[model samples]
Target: MSASRRTEARLLSHDEQQLVRTTHHPAIYEHGLDALHELRRRLRALRDRERTLLHHKMREIRGKAEPRGGSFPGLADHPGRRRQLFAQALKRVNAEASRLARMTARAVIGDGARRALALRKTGEQWLRPAPSPSPAPAPDPRPRPNRRGKSHIPGRQVGSVSQANRRAQAARDARPAPPA
Candidate 1:
C-alpha cells in the first residue's frame, strides 16, 4: 500500500501484502526474471568498467591520438545509457516480483474464502436437525420368495443391499415407533 500494485486487483491490506512477498513463492516463472537480473548486472558491470573498456578500445584503434566528441559523440552518453539500462532492467524485475507477490496474496485470499464458505455450510448444518429415519411403507404380507416370485419390497432386489443401506436399515429398526 506504499503506492499501489498495477498487476493485481486491489484487495490485500498492508500486512497481507508483506505476507505475500515472503510466504507465497516468488516463482522463477520460466526464467524471465532471472534473465532480467543477469541483464541488469551485466549493464552495471559495463558501466563500472567503462574506463578500462574505453582505454582498450582507444589503444587498439589509435596509439597516441586524443579522442574528441566528433569521432565518438555517443561516448559522452554511453555511461548514462548503461546506467539507465541497468536501472530499467532492475525496475522490470521489481515490477514482476511485485506481480508474483500480488498473485500469492490473491491465492491466500481465495483459499480463505473457500474455507470460510465450508465453515458457513458446516455451521448451518449443525444448526439444522438431521432428517429422522423412517420405515418403508407397508409391504405385501403374503409376498412369494425371490427368484420365483415378486419381492416383498417393490423396486428393491431381494438380497441386494449396500453397507450404507444396511446401516440405515439398522438405524430405522433400532428406533421405536412414535406414539400416536
Candidate 2:
C-alpha cells in the first residue's frame, strides 16, 4: 500500500478507535467544570451585592450620612426619602439573596449529578448495596368512626352572642303589653 494509505489504515485501527471513545468525554467534563465555576462566581457576586445593599439600609436606619467609619456624610434627614430608600434597598437585597440561594442549590445538585456520573464511569462498585424498596403497609380494615351526626353543633353556630341577642330581642318584642 502507498505510504498515505498505510497511515490512514493505521489511524483507523481498533485500538485508535477505542482510545478516541475513551477520551471523548473529557470535553463534556471540562464543560461541566466551567459551568460550576461560573455558577460559583455568580453566587459570590450576588452575595456581595446583598451585603452592600444591607449595609446601605443599616446606615439609613441609624441616620448616618455614610457607613460606619467612613468620611462621607449620612443621607439627608428626610423621613419620607429614608423610608423609600430603605424599602427599595431591602427589596433589592432580598432579591439578590434569593437568587444566590437558588444558584447555590442548583450548583450543589449539578455537582452531585456530575460526581455520580464520574463514579459510574470509573467502574467502582458502591460500598453498600442500594436498599430495596419496602412494600407499602396494608390499609387498616377497621371502619372509621362517623364524625357527622345530629346534636354536634359546630362551634361557629354554638356560642354566637349576636344570634343570642337577636333571639332575645325577638322574644321580648313578641310579648303582649300589660293592660293599661
Candidate 3:
C-alpha cells in the first residue's frame, strides 16, 4: 500500500486570511449575521411606521372632506365657507406630509449611523481618527498699538469752537423771519 500526502492552501494576503477566518469562524459569522438582522429589523420597523403614518394622514384628509354637521339651512349654502374649509384642510395635510418626510429622513440617518457603528466594530479600519486639533494657531507676532491717532478733530485748529458758534449765530440772523 502507498501513503498519500496532503498539502495546505495558503492565503495570499492578510485581507484574504481575514476573509477566510470570517467565513469559517462561527462566532464572527454569528455576530455579523446579528448585525445584518438588526439592520433589517430597523428598516422594517421604519417602513411599518411610515405606512401607519400615511394611513393616518389619509384618514385625516378624508375626515376633513366630510361635513361635520347635518345639511344646514343657510350656512352650508355659502360657497366661500366651503372653499375656505377646503383650503385649510389642504394646508393641514401638506404640513403633516412635510413632518412625516422629516421623520423618515431622520430614521434613515439613524439607520446609517447604526450600520456605520457595526462596520467599525467588525474590524473594518476604513474610518480614520479625527485629526488632532490644529495646533492652537500660533500667537500672532505683530504688536497691537494701545491707542489710535491724535484725539483732536482734523482740519480744525485748537480753540476753534468759539469761531464756529459765532458763524452759526450770524447765519441765523441773516435768514428772514417767518411770516407772523
Candidate 4:
C-alpha cells in the first residue's frame, strides 16, 4: 500500500477526531476503535489477497525479472531475496498492527479518564453531606399505632428455626397415635 493510504487505513481523519471530541456523542462509539476494526478487516483481506498473489504471481513476477537479450538481471528466484521481501512485508504488517493497538489503547485510556472526571464531578455533588435540619430526634417510648395485630408476636421472631420446630412438635402431638 502507498504511504498515504496506509496511514489513512490505520488512523481516523483529523476531522473525525475533532468531531468525536466536540460532539455530544454516545459513550459506546469511538473513532480510534472503529479505525482499528477497519484496519483489521482490511488487513485480513490484504493477507488473503497477498497469499493468493504470492502463490499465483510468483512465477509471473519471476518471469518479468528474467534477463532480456541485453542487460543482466539478478537471480529471478533468489531464495535470500524472496525471504527478505516477505520478511519486510511481515515486519510492516506487525508494525502497523502494533501501531493500531497502541492508538486504540490510548483512546480507551482517554475515554476512561474523561468518564472518571465526569463521575468525580457528579460524585462531588453527592459527596457533600446532605444538610439535615437539626439533630436526629430521640425515638418515642410508645409503639407505633400499626405495631399491634394478631399476626405479630412481642419477642419471639417469625420464620425462626425454633418456631418451625415448635410447630412441627405441636402438629405431631395433635395427630392421633398410630395403630399398634
In the range 5-71, model 2's lDDT, one tens digit per residue, is 2332343335433322322224223324344344335434534544565567567678884553544
Q: How many pairs collide in each candidate, listed in order?
A: 0, 5, 0, 0
| lDDT of every model, 2 decimals | 0.52, 0.51, 0.48, 0.50
Global lDDT for candidate 2?
0.51
Q: Which residue pairs clash in candidate 4? A: none
* TM-scores for candidates 1 onward, in order: 0.32, 0.30, 0.28, 0.30
Which candidate comes out best when scored by lDDT?
1
Candidate 1 deviant stretches above 4 angstroms? 1-29, 32-77, 124-180
The residue-by-residue lDDT of candidate 4 on 95-114, one tens digit each, is 55576688879999999999
Model 1, position 143: C-alpha lDDT score: 67
| Winner on TM-score (1 vs 2) | 1
Lowest summed-lDDT stretch of 10 residues in model 2?
Answer: 19-28
Query: Model 3: which ten-residue window has the lowest total lDDT?
Result: 2-11
lDDT of 3 by residue, 1-180 (tens): 111111001211344233223322242324333443443354344335444444544565688544434553442233332333323323433444455568779999999999989997997877787877887655876767878777767666665898999999999999999999
Each model's RMSD to truth, in Å? 23.2, 22.0, 25.4, 15.8
Winner on lDDT between 1 and 3 is: 1
Off by over 4 Å in 2: 1-77, 130-180
Q: Could you tell me how far off, in angstroms, the CA of residue 162 lies in candidate 2 after the best superposition?
A: 47
